[model samples]
Target: MDNSLAELDARVSGCRACPRLVDWREEVARTKRAAFADWTYWGRPVPGFGPPDASLLVIGLAPAAHGGNRTGRMFTGDRSGDVLYAALHEVGLASQPTSLSVDDGLTLYGVRVTSPVHCAPPDNKPTPWERDTCRPWLVTELKLLRPTLRAVVVLGAFGWQAALPAFAEAGWTVPRPRPAFSHGARIALESPTNNPLELFGCFHVSQRNTFTRRLTPEMLRNVLRTAAEAAGLPTRPYAG
Candidate 1:
């Protein structure tokens, strides 16, 4: 493993910032042991997966119950993740065909995916306190990734909120007037250190969004392509 990945793994394995999340994950692991008996629960914090020098960072809300919680990778083995990885692959960000598990040999090129709350929350919702507790890890990760990070794509409103502080800490003001979360909205800011950070917002690829037609694969692809272009990446032609 790379040094950054090793450090991330250690931090995630030893994370105890939120006792409730720790306990909750343990309970879920124990109760659902028969189902995931052979799986080793990271049970601590979850970290981003991709090259350390990735230019794009995709921030998500939290892990899905059977997705990252089980596969030990954010956005893996779940419906939402399916759409996400498919889009990533379509855009040439992903190396493998799909993201099913850690052992699936999947990799990201210029992008990486992470979440505000590392562990899977109950009912897929995390309390404000839990979000706060996990903020520092996000901060550290951003700092470590600052060298190559040029753009951040927040998957949902919640993710936008969770990522705001990190941008602020990096000295990126919300563009004089705050940048709000609206589908297809884009914002640009300079970090405190004067590093540029471009941001894009999009509705999550949840089942409800898909079933209700609130978010379509075409729309998500467009948003990503726009973000990539803004970040100085080669944009893929829109397939839709």
Candidate 2:
């Protein structure tokens, strides 16, 4: 097992374990989106973004074909990111409200953002096989984060499902008959060999949810504030 997050991330970024994901990501990169025609796509797997010692971790489903796959940074250059980052900023977990590019000067404070499937999938849905194949990366990441990690906010059911097993593998004992996912759900987990951790669920920041008000900015900020507090991190009051 890699002892450092940097080494684990380097290995993750170059992974080609899932051929379907590999082909799809590369194809999208080559056939660049019209709006991002001048951009050089970071077609490889998108690694987690934030400091290694983060106490709070936010897990998403996967990278968007034109978002992370284009920018090489998870959640960057996408509508989902706009909602997520803005909420994080409002809750004082992020330094800024925007995440346009990797160099956009946006920094996550005491939080890290990652996804189960690093590469972008076709139609924004990764296959079960691909998610399983990509599981070890998350497991390793969780283990690497064990020292200071305390709370996790899983966005959407897919991420919620993916995260539980990884948490188990990383030393947190998941309850029997695994917990069902629901927005605003919070579960406390204990580990004999590791620190106790809290898990939270929220609706994804996808456009469908945001446009319909299924996940309003205030709703997202509520979850972040609760999670950040649970993780022992201080959060600023919502400026708005």
What's model 2's TM-score? 0.99
**Segments in model 2 whose C-alpha atoms lie over 4 Å from true places:** none
Best by TM-score: 2
Query: How well does candidate 2 score on lDDT at residue 195?
Result: 83
Compute each candidate's TM-score over C-alphas.
0.91, 0.99
Q: Where's the lowest-lDDT run of ten residues in candidate 2?
A: 162-171
Q: For model 1, what is the C-alpha lDDT against the true structure? A: 0.79
Q: What lDDT, from 0 to 1, does candidate 2 have?
A: 0.94
lDDT tens readout by residue for model 1, 87-196 = 88777677764788888989887888888888888888999989888877777777777878889899998888888886776556766556778888788877557569
lDDT per prediction?
0.79, 0.94
